[model samples]
Target: MKLLPMFALLIAGFIPLTSAYVDELSNERVFFNKMLEVLPGNWQGKYADGTYENPTSDWQPIEVNYQITSGDTAIIENYVDGNESAIMTTVYHLDNNDIRATHFCGAQNHPRMAGRVFDRSSNTLSLNFVDVSNLQTPADYHSRGIDLKIIDHDNVHVTFSGLENGEDSTRVFALTRSQK
Candidate 1:
Protein backbone atom coordinates (compact mmCIF):
# COMPACT_ATOMS: atom_id res chain seq x y z
CA MET A 1 0.00 0.00 0.00
CA LYS A 2 2.89 2.39 0.77
CA LEU A 3 4.59 1.64 -2.60
CA LEU A 4 1.38 2.33 -4.57
CA PRO A 5 1.25 6.01 -3.57
CA MET A 6 4.92 6.55 -4.57
CA PHE A 7 4.33 4.92 -7.94
CA ALA A 8 1.41 7.24 -8.65
CA LEU A 9 3.49 10.29 -7.78
CA LEU A 10 6.28 9.25 -10.14
CA ILE A 11 3.83 8.73 -12.99
CA ALA A 12 2.29 12.14 -12.38
CA GLY A 13 5.68 13.80 -12.60
CA PHE A 14 6.31 12.40 -16.08
CA ILE A 15 2.91 13.36 -17.45
CA PRO A 16 3.55 17.02 -18.16
CA LEU A 17 6.75 16.37 -20.09
CA THR A 18 5.16 13.65 -22.14
CA SER A 19 2.08 15.71 -22.87
CA ALA A 20 3.61 19.12 -23.38
CA TYR A 21 1.78 19.50 -26.69
CA VAL A 22 -1.58 18.27 -25.54
CA ASP A 23 -3.14 21.56 -26.53
CA GLU A 24 -2.45 20.92 -30.21
CA LEU A 25 -5.83 20.69 -31.89
CA SER A 26 -6.92 18.92 -35.05
CA ASN A 27 -8.84 21.94 -36.32
CA GLU A 28 -5.74 24.05 -35.95
CA ARG A 29 -3.69 21.46 -37.82
CA VAL A 30 -6.18 21.60 -40.65
CA PHE A 31 -5.74 25.34 -40.98
CA PHE A 32 -1.97 25.21 -40.61
CA ASN A 33 -1.71 22.56 -43.29
CA LYS A 34 -3.94 24.60 -45.56
CA MET A 35 -1.59 27.55 -45.21
CA LEU A 36 1.39 25.37 -46.09
CA GLU A 37 0.20 25.03 -49.66
CA VAL A 38 2.03 28.24 -50.54
CA LEU A 39 5.41 27.13 -49.19
CA PRO A 40 6.90 24.52 -51.54
CA GLY A 41 8.85 26.61 -54.02
CA ASN A 42 11.90 28.81 -54.48
CA TRP A 43 11.77 32.48 -53.57
CA GLN A 44 13.99 35.50 -54.13
CA GLY A 45 14.20 37.83 -51.20
CA LYS A 46 16.10 40.50 -49.28
CA TYR A 47 16.80 40.93 -45.61
CA ALA A 48 15.32 43.84 -43.67
CA ASP A 49 18.73 44.98 -42.46
CA GLY A 50 20.30 44.40 -45.84
CA THR A 51 22.83 47.18 -45.37
CA TYR A 52 24.24 45.43 -42.32
CA GLU A 53 24.23 41.95 -43.85
CA ASN A 54 25.55 43.27 -47.09
CA PRO A 55 27.53 46.46 -47.75
CA THR A 56 25.11 47.14 -50.61
CA SER A 57 21.58 48.53 -50.42
CA ASP A 58 18.77 47.50 -48.05
CA TRP A 59 17.60 44.96 -50.66
CA GLN A 60 20.53 42.57 -50.74
CA PRO A 61 19.79 39.32 -52.48
CA ILE A 62 18.79 36.21 -50.57
CA GLU A 63 17.34 32.91 -51.70
CA VAL A 64 14.73 30.78 -49.96
CA ASN A 65 13.76 27.30 -50.99
CA TYR A 66 11.12 25.13 -49.43
CA GLN A 67 11.01 21.35 -49.83
CA ILE A 68 8.34 19.06 -48.53
CA THR A 69 9.03 15.40 -47.99
CA SER A 70 7.81 12.44 -45.95
CA GLY A 71 4.18 13.03 -46.69
CA ASP A 72 2.38 16.13 -45.40
CA THR A 73 4.02 16.26 -42.00
CA ALA A 74 7.57 17.42 -42.75
CA ILE A 75 8.62 20.66 -44.38
CA ILE A 76 12.13 21.99 -44.89
CA GLU A 77 13.24 25.58 -45.52
CA ASN A 78 16.63 26.44 -46.91
CA TYR A 79 18.09 29.94 -46.83
CA VAL A 80 21.06 31.14 -48.81
CA ASP A 81 22.31 34.68 -48.50
CA GLY A 82 24.64 36.76 -50.67
CA ASN A 83 25.57 34.28 -53.37
CA GLU A 84 25.59 31.41 -50.90
CA SER A 85 27.92 33.08 -48.43
CA ALA A 86 25.70 32.07 -45.53
CA ILE A 87 23.35 29.10 -45.38
CA MET A 88 20.92 27.73 -42.79
CA THR A 89 17.96 25.40 -42.55
CA THR A 90 14.78 25.10 -40.56
CA VAL A 91 12.70 21.93 -40.31
CA TYR A 92 9.03 22.07 -39.44
CA HIS A 93 6.16 19.73 -38.72
CA LEU A 94 2.58 20.05 -37.58
CA ASP A 95 1.23 19.03 -34.21
CA ASN A 96 -2.46 19.69 -34.53
CA ASN A 97 -2.64 23.40 -35.47
CA ASP A 98 0.65 24.27 -33.74
CA ILE A 99 3.73 24.17 -35.91
CA ARG A 100 7.13 23.33 -34.46
CA ALA A 101 10.52 24.06 -35.97
CA THR A 102 14.11 23.19 -35.19
CA HIS A 103 16.44 25.86 -36.52
CA PHE A 104 19.83 24.54 -37.51
CA CYS A 105 22.02 27.40 -36.43
CA GLY A 106 25.55 28.13 -37.56
CA ALA A 107 26.50 28.78 -33.97
CA GLN A 108 26.53 26.44 -30.96
CA ASN A 109 22.94 25.53 -30.25
CA HIS A 110 19.93 24.31 -32.29
CA PRO A 111 16.94 26.18 -30.92
CA ARG A 112 13.44 24.80 -31.29
CA MET A 113 10.46 27.13 -31.47
CA ALA A 114 6.71 26.63 -31.78
CA GLY A 115 4.23 28.57 -33.91
CA ARG A 116 0.54 29.16 -34.31
CA VAL A 117 -1.61 31.53 -36.35
CA PHE A 118 -1.74 34.90 -34.55
CA ASP A 119 -5.50 34.80 -34.84
CA ARG A 120 -8.03 32.49 -36.39
CA SER A 121 -8.92 35.24 -38.85
CA SER A 122 -5.35 36.30 -39.51
CA ASN A 123 -2.71 34.67 -41.65
CA THR A 124 0.29 35.70 -39.57
CA LEU A 125 2.21 32.95 -37.88
CA SER A 126 4.05 33.77 -34.66
CA LEU A 127 6.55 31.39 -33.20
CA ASN A 128 8.00 31.70 -29.73
CA PHE A 129 10.59 29.78 -27.76
CA VAL A 130 9.24 26.79 -25.93
CA ASP A 131 12.31 24.85 -24.74
CA VAL A 132 15.77 24.02 -25.98
CA SER A 133 17.59 20.77 -25.40
CA ASN A 134 21.31 21.53 -25.93
CA LEU A 135 21.17 25.16 -24.76
CA GLN A 136 22.45 26.01 -21.31
CA THR A 137 20.01 28.67 -20.08
CA PRO A 138 21.44 32.22 -20.35
CA ALA A 139 24.88 30.89 -21.20
CA ASP A 140 24.20 29.89 -24.80
CA TYR A 141 22.88 32.19 -27.52
CA HIS A 142 19.75 31.26 -29.52
CA SER A 143 16.83 32.60 -31.49
CA ARG A 144 13.92 33.73 -29.36
CA GLY A 145 11.06 34.09 -31.84
CA ILE A 146 9.91 34.46 -35.47
CA ASP A 147 6.96 36.02 -37.27
CA LEU A 148 5.84 35.00 -40.75
CA LYS A 149 3.40 37.25 -42.55
CA ILE A 150 1.75 36.00 -45.68
CA ILE A 151 1.11 39.07 -47.74
CA ASP A 152 -0.29 37.31 -50.82
CA HIS A 153 0.14 34.27 -53.00
CA ASP A 154 3.57 35.43 -54.07
CA ASN A 155 4.84 37.66 -51.28
CA VAL A 156 5.80 36.92 -47.69
CA HIS A 157 7.58 38.73 -44.90
CA VAL A 158 9.68 36.89 -42.38
CA THR A 159 11.10 38.27 -39.17
CA PHE A 160 13.54 36.56 -36.87
CA SER A 161 14.14 37.76 -33.32
CA GLY A 162 17.15 36.67 -31.34
CA LEU A 163 19.17 37.30 -28.24
CA GLU A 164 22.43 38.71 -29.51
CA ASN A 165 25.21 40.09 -27.32
CA GLY A 166 22.91 39.88 -24.28
CA GLU A 167 20.38 42.08 -26.05
CA ASP A 168 17.25 41.36 -28.08
CA SER A 169 17.24 42.11 -31.78
CA THR A 170 15.32 41.32 -34.96
CA ARG A 171 16.03 40.80 -38.65
CA VAL A 172 13.42 40.91 -41.40
CA PHE A 173 13.20 39.47 -44.89
CA ALA A 174 10.99 40.33 -47.84
CA LEU A 175 10.47 37.34 -50.14
CA THR A 176 8.80 36.92 -53.52
CA ARG A 177 7.95 33.53 -54.94
CA SER A 178 9.89 32.26 -57.90
CA GLN A 179 8.10 31.13 -61.05
CA LYS A 180 10.30 28.09 -61.37
Candidate 2:
Protein backbone atom coordinates (compact mmCIF):
# COMPACT_ATOMS: atom_id res chain seq x y z
CA MET A 1 0.00 0.00 0.00
CA LYS A 2 2.86 2.37 0.86
CA LEU A 3 4.67 1.44 -2.36
CA LEU A 4 1.57 2.37 -4.40
CA PRO A 5 1.51 5.86 -2.86
CA MET A 6 5.27 6.34 -3.49
CA PHE A 7 4.94 5.32 -7.14
CA ALA A 8 2.09 7.74 -7.66
CA LEU A 9 4.17 10.55 -6.21
CA LEU A 10 7.10 9.67 -8.44
CA ILE A 11 4.96 9.72 -11.57
CA ALA A 12 3.39 13.03 -10.59
CA GLY A 13 6.85 14.55 -10.13
CA PHE A 14 7.77 13.86 -13.77
CA ILE A 15 4.60 15.31 -15.30
CA PRO A 16 5.68 18.94 -15.08
CA LEU A 17 9.13 18.20 -16.44
CA THR A 18 7.73 16.41 -19.45
CA SER A 19 5.24 19.17 -20.12
CA ALA A 20 7.97 21.78 -19.86
CA TYR A 21 10.17 19.92 -22.31
CA VAL A 22 7.36 19.66 -24.82
CA ASP A 23 6.60 23.34 -24.43
CA GLU A 24 10.24 24.22 -24.96
CA LEU A 25 10.37 22.25 -28.19
CA SER A 26 7.19 23.89 -29.47
CA ASN A 27 8.59 27.34 -28.72
CA GLU A 28 11.83 26.52 -30.48
CA ARG A 29 9.99 25.46 -33.63
CA VAL A 30 7.60 28.37 -33.89
CA PHE A 31 9.68 30.13 -36.54
CA PHE A 32 10.12 27.02 -38.65
CA ASN A 33 6.42 26.26 -38.46
CA LYS A 34 5.63 29.81 -39.49
CA MET A 35 7.81 29.42 -42.57
CA LEU A 36 6.09 26.17 -43.52
CA GLU A 37 2.78 27.92 -43.12
CA VAL A 38 3.35 30.86 -45.51
CA LEU A 39 5.87 29.71 -48.12
CA PRO A 40 4.29 26.80 -49.98
CA GLY A 41 3.34 28.43 -53.28
CA ASN A 42 4.58 30.17 -56.42
CA TRP A 43 6.05 33.65 -56.17
CA GLN A 44 7.02 36.01 -58.99
CA GLY A 45 9.27 39.00 -58.76
CA LYS A 46 12.27 40.81 -60.20
CA TYR A 47 15.90 40.98 -59.24
CA ALA A 48 16.72 44.25 -57.57
CA ASP A 49 18.67 46.87 -59.48
CA GLY A 50 22.38 46.27 -60.18
CA THR A 51 22.16 42.57 -59.39
CA TYR A 52 21.24 41.08 -62.76
CA GLU A 53 23.68 38.59 -64.21
CA ASN A 54 23.92 40.53 -67.46
CA PRO A 55 24.56 43.77 -65.54
CA THR A 56 21.37 45.33 -66.85
CA SER A 57 20.03 48.51 -65.27
CA ASP A 58 16.59 47.08 -65.68
CA TRP A 59 15.06 44.60 -63.26
CA GLN A 60 15.06 41.03 -64.51
CA PRO A 61 12.16 38.69 -64.00
CA ILE A 62 12.54 35.83 -61.55
CA GLU A 63 10.26 33.17 -60.26
CA VAL A 64 10.38 30.95 -57.20
CA ASN A 65 8.35 28.01 -56.06
CA TYR A 66 8.13 26.24 -52.74
CA GLN A 67 6.61 22.93 -51.79
CA ILE A 68 6.51 20.75 -48.72
CA THR A 69 8.31 17.47 -49.29
CA SER A 70 9.66 14.38 -47.55
CA GLY A 71 6.40 13.83 -45.76
CA ASP A 72 6.42 17.36 -44.39
CA THR A 73 9.93 17.03 -43.03
CA ALA A 74 11.31 19.49 -45.54
CA ILE A 75 10.48 22.49 -47.70
CA ILE A 76 12.01 22.69 -51.13
CA GLU A 77 12.47 26.00 -52.95
CA ASN A 78 13.13 26.22 -56.65
CA TYR A 79 14.52 29.28 -58.37
CA VAL A 80 13.53 29.82 -61.97
CA ASP A 81 15.49 32.11 -64.25
CA GLY A 82 14.35 34.25 -67.18
CA ASN A 83 14.85 31.30 -69.50
CA GLU A 84 12.30 29.42 -67.41
CA SER A 85 14.91 26.93 -66.35
CA ALA A 86 15.62 25.89 -62.81
CA ILE A 87 18.69 27.65 -61.56
CA MET A 88 18.89 26.39 -58.05
CA THR A 89 17.02 24.46 -55.40
CA THR A 90 17.15 24.85 -51.63
CA VAL A 91 15.91 22.38 -49.10
CA TYR A 92 14.95 23.58 -45.62
CA HIS A 93 14.57 21.30 -42.65
CA LEU A 94 14.80 21.35 -38.89
CA ASP A 95 17.77 19.65 -37.24
CA ASN A 96 18.71 19.63 -33.59
CA ASN A 97 16.08 22.28 -32.91
CA ASP A 98 17.54 24.61 -35.52
CA ILE A 99 16.41 25.47 -39.03
CA ARG A 100 18.92 24.38 -41.64
CA ALA A 101 19.07 24.78 -45.42
CA THR A 102 21.00 23.05 -48.14
CA HIS A 103 21.35 25.16 -51.27
CA PHE A 104 21.95 23.36 -54.55
CA CYS A 105 23.56 25.98 -56.72
CA GLY A 106 23.92 26.35 -60.45
CA ALA A 107 27.56 26.91 -59.68
CA GLN A 108 27.63 23.14 -59.08
CA ASN A 109 28.22 23.20 -55.39
CA HIS A 110 26.06 22.71 -52.32
CA PRO A 111 26.29 25.11 -49.39
CA ARG A 112 24.60 24.30 -46.14
CA MET A 113 23.39 27.08 -43.85
CA ALA A 114 21.70 27.28 -40.49
CA GLY A 115 19.10 29.79 -39.31
CA ARG A 116 20.25 30.62 -35.83
CA VAL A 117 18.65 34.00 -35.50
CA PHE A 118 14.94 34.69 -35.84
CA ASP A 119 13.13 37.92 -35.15
CA ARG A 120 9.52 37.27 -34.41
CA SER A 121 8.50 40.91 -34.42
CA SER A 122 9.89 41.44 -37.93
CA ASN A 123 9.07 37.97 -39.16
CA THR A 124 12.60 37.58 -40.39
CA LEU A 125 15.02 34.68 -40.43
CA SER A 126 18.68 34.80 -41.38
CA LEU A 127 20.72 31.77 -42.31
CA ASN A 128 24.49 31.77 -42.63
CA PHE A 129 26.73 29.26 -44.30
CA VAL A 130 28.08 26.47 -42.16
CA ASP A 131 29.66 23.98 -44.57
CA VAL A 132 29.58 22.98 -48.21
CA SER A 133 29.92 19.99 -50.50
CA ASN A 134 31.54 19.64 -53.95
CA LEU A 135 33.31 22.95 -53.66
CA GLN A 136 36.23 22.53 -55.98
CA THR A 137 38.14 25.40 -54.45
CA PRO A 138 37.89 27.93 -51.66
CA ALA A 139 37.28 30.68 -54.24
CA ASP A 140 34.63 28.79 -56.14
CA TYR A 141 31.28 30.48 -56.57
CA HIS A 142 28.63 29.35 -54.08
CA SER A 143 25.78 30.63 -52.03
CA ARG A 144 27.02 32.24 -48.83
CA GLY A 145 23.81 32.87 -46.98
CA ILE A 146 20.12 33.75 -47.27
CA ASP A 147 17.85 36.17 -45.50
CA LEU A 148 14.10 35.59 -45.55
CA LYS A 149 11.51 38.16 -44.56
CA ILE A 150 7.86 37.28 -44.50
CA ILE A 151 5.85 40.41 -45.13
CA ASP A 152 2.57 38.58 -45.13
CA HIS A 153 0.87 35.52 -46.46
CA ASP A 154 0.86 37.10 -49.93
CA ASN A 155 4.19 38.83 -50.00
CA VAL A 156 7.82 38.24 -49.07
CA HIS A 157 11.28 39.68 -49.45
CA VAL A 158 14.41 37.61 -49.77
CA THR A 159 18.07 38.37 -50.13
CA PHE A 160 20.39 35.74 -51.49
CA SER A 161 24.05 36.38 -50.83
CA GLY A 162 26.86 34.51 -52.43
CA LEU A 163 30.58 34.37 -52.98
CA GLU A 164 32.02 34.41 -56.49
CA ASN A 165 35.76 34.17 -56.91
CA GLY A 166 35.91 34.99 -53.21
CA GLU A 167 33.94 38.22 -53.72
CA ASP A 168 30.59 38.98 -52.18
CA SER A 169 27.53 38.90 -54.49
CA THR A 170 23.98 39.62 -53.52
CA ARG A 171 20.50 39.64 -55.06
CA VAL A 172 17.35 40.91 -53.45
CA PHE A 173 13.81 40.05 -54.46
CA ALA A 174 10.43 41.43 -53.54
CA LEU A 175 7.96 38.71 -54.35
CA THR A 176 4.20 38.55 -54.50
CA ARG A 177 2.19 35.39 -54.53
CA SER A 178 1.38 34.23 -58.05
CA GLN A 179 -2.21 33.32 -58.61
CA LYS A 180 -1.21 31.06 -61.46
Model 2 stretches with alpha carbons more than 4 Å out: 1-28, 49-57, 82-84
- Weakest 10 consecutive residues, lDDT, candidate 2? 49-58
- lDDT, candidates in the order shown: 0.72, 0.82
* Model 2 agreement with the true structure over 1-180: per-residue lDDT tens digits: 999999999999999999876655554478778778989989998777333334335666789999998777799998997786889899999886777899998899999998856666777788999999999999898888888888899988777788878678787777889999
lDDT of 2: 0.82
lDDT of 1 by residue, 1-180 (tens): 999999999999889766654433543465457557888889987786422344233556789988888777888888977575438787888864678888876555778888754644456677888766566667556787777777778987777778866977677777899876
RMSD of candidate 2 to the true fold? 7.2
Error of 2 at 63 (Å): 1.1
Maximum-lDDT candidate: 2
TM-score for model 2? Answer: 0.76
